[model samples]
Target: MKLNHSVTGQDQGLPIMLVHGLFGQGRNLGAIARRLSEQRRVILVDQRNHGDSPHDPDHSYAAMAGDLAEVIGAFGGRVDLAGHSMGGKAAMHLALTQPELIRKLAVMDIAPVAYAHSQNHLVDAMAAMDLQGVVRRSEADRRLSEHIHDTGLRAFLLQSLDLKSDPPRWRLNLPALRDWMDRTTGWPEGLPKGIFDGPALFMAGAESDYVDDAGEAAIREYFPQARLLRIKHAGHWMHADAPEAVAETLSAFMGGG
Candidate 1:
């Protein structure tokens, strides 16, 4: 599947590829991508079934990882990879399955283990919205309030709504995403034990339980060369909540790794 993407920066050295969280487009990480682009080619990608990417029935991590592989093959042979949330999970799967294609891996606010948090309701909430019936963003916002009360979260999800569409369409394949939420939150089944010896950075949000001391054990086991960092005043969406810290850490990894 040809995924939607945008490239920035022309400086030499290894390129950086960034993947965004669920319900987010590649441009979600534009700020960080632009910063890294100053010294390296940065490719911001919109994962399958999201953003402008064509919708597919399957939404497993393996499938998502494969889409990323196809993307890298088109851009370059290998790259420094950074992913957040669901994107982080896809990055881990790609690195573990194809270590040669990745020079270094950076996983933000996610671990190699299955998450206890259930985001299915978020999917359900989005699915419940009748985009065709709504004519204005305010009505959509009001309907969304029935499921989500957080202002920031509503804004995030609403970004996928194509307001100008004749019938008002969603950029995301809601059903596919809803069906795959469990798999997205769960680690791949029967994955090989091959360790990615290449350096990896696992950044956790200070307020997010996505990665904790117990989870670090799994990360270290899968990526023996992995190191952890915690960004202050952030939640599961650290890249959005703490852009400067995330960019600094990513730049350090790209330059030093």
Candidate 2:
């Protein structure tokens, strides 16, 4: 399917595949990938329906997992996988569904359980932007500021905007994303029983609500061998917020050091 990816480092070592969160592209993890590249091959993948990948009506973890498997197959099978938020959930699904394709797994700041509908404000803010009349990216930023007060969040969302020869346009499929909002926010149900016994890493931002003390039991249930790491003073985007800490943790886990 020609899934968009950014590869770094030497190709000889164990390949590490990165999957980004909702509203994020492969480039979101570019910094992390570059750092990890020194010792390992890193491939940052843009999940379907999000970045430069093909868009489809299907938005569930099952479909996303399959898409991940396809990408892995293209890479000659077997990879160390790491994901954040929605991508984290998808990585879990991939590990559980296609165990053979994954060497080890890392899920950042997300539990296996279905998340509540808390992203409504973000969705509303994106939808409220008049895409048709948007002449400049700055104007879009101004409009987003009315609904999303956080400048960081507004800037993160606006990264998807790009200029084409004809006119400025949004690379993301906003309408499809909006339609599948519920599916994206929620987790997939009904896994056959039994945990993914392979090595797993569960990383959470200490200040993030995405993973809490109460969620540990469920996370352990699915990933029995999973080791949890917490990055202090970081929010949902821990990898970006604390790249050095995240990189250290990931390197240790990957190397079994």
Candidate 3:
């Protein structure tokens, strides 16, 4: 499927693609995309079932990677890819399977291992809501807060809630995403090991346990040339917590420094 995307910057140099985390659209990373687009082209993609991308029942790593591959094939022969959370897993899979299409890989705050914790409640809360009667964003948010107490997370997730639509529908395919929570949260099985040996950067959040000492073993096994860096004072949402630092690190990693 042709994924929805935004392109910025010049046609010169190796282009960079920014893949947002779960429940995010391409425009969610507009700040980071604009910052990175200064010297080179930047492509912000909405993964399948998120944003304006097509919704499919298959929401696995392989399928997401295939979507990224298609984007790379269309935008450039190869691209420098950076992804956050769920998007990071897709980047890793694409880099591993189609190494030639990715010049460099950057995975932010997530490893290739399956996460023990599940975000099923987040999905379920979204899926449970019927936004047809919701007249205002605040009302929707207030109702959502009954299920999801976190204000910041509700704000982020609500970006995909199309309040401007006639009936105020959710831009995200909540049912399809909710159904594949297991595969979305965990790393896919049956993939070959350490297929990507190119320069790799794993930017972790100092405040997040997504990348721990226990996870390093698996990181090394999959990406032998990978280097890990921590964004101080940031959590899983490092870009939001430390936008400047994240952008700076991204620029340096992509050799724009």
Model 1, span 182-254: residue lDDT tens: 8888899777654688989999999999898778999888888888999999899888899988899899987
For candidate 3, lDDT tens digit of each residue in 131-207?
87888889999989989999999999998998878888888888878878788888888777788878999999999
Greater-TM-score candidate between 1 and 3: 3
Which stretches in model 3 have alpha-carbon errors above 4 Å? none
Candidate 3 C-alpha error for residue 245, in Å: 0.3
Cα distance off (Å), candidate 1, residue 54: 0.7
Worst 10 residues of 2 by lDDT: 162-171
Instruction: Rank candidates, TM-score, best first.
Output: 3, 1, 2
Clashes of each: 0, 0, 0
Candidate 1 yields a Cα-based lDDT of: 0.89
**What is the TM-score of candidate 3?**
0.97
Q: Pick by TM-score: which candidate is best? A: 3
Taking all chains together, the TM-score of candidate 1 against the true structure is 0.95
What lDDT does candidate 2 reach at residue 158? 86
What tens digits encode model 2's per-residue C-alpha lDDT throughout 135-209?
777888887788889988888888877644235556677676777778788767787434577889899999898
**Where does model 1 exceed 4 Å of error?**
133-135
Better of 2 and 3 by lDDT: 3
Give the winner by TM-score: 1 or 2. Answer: 1
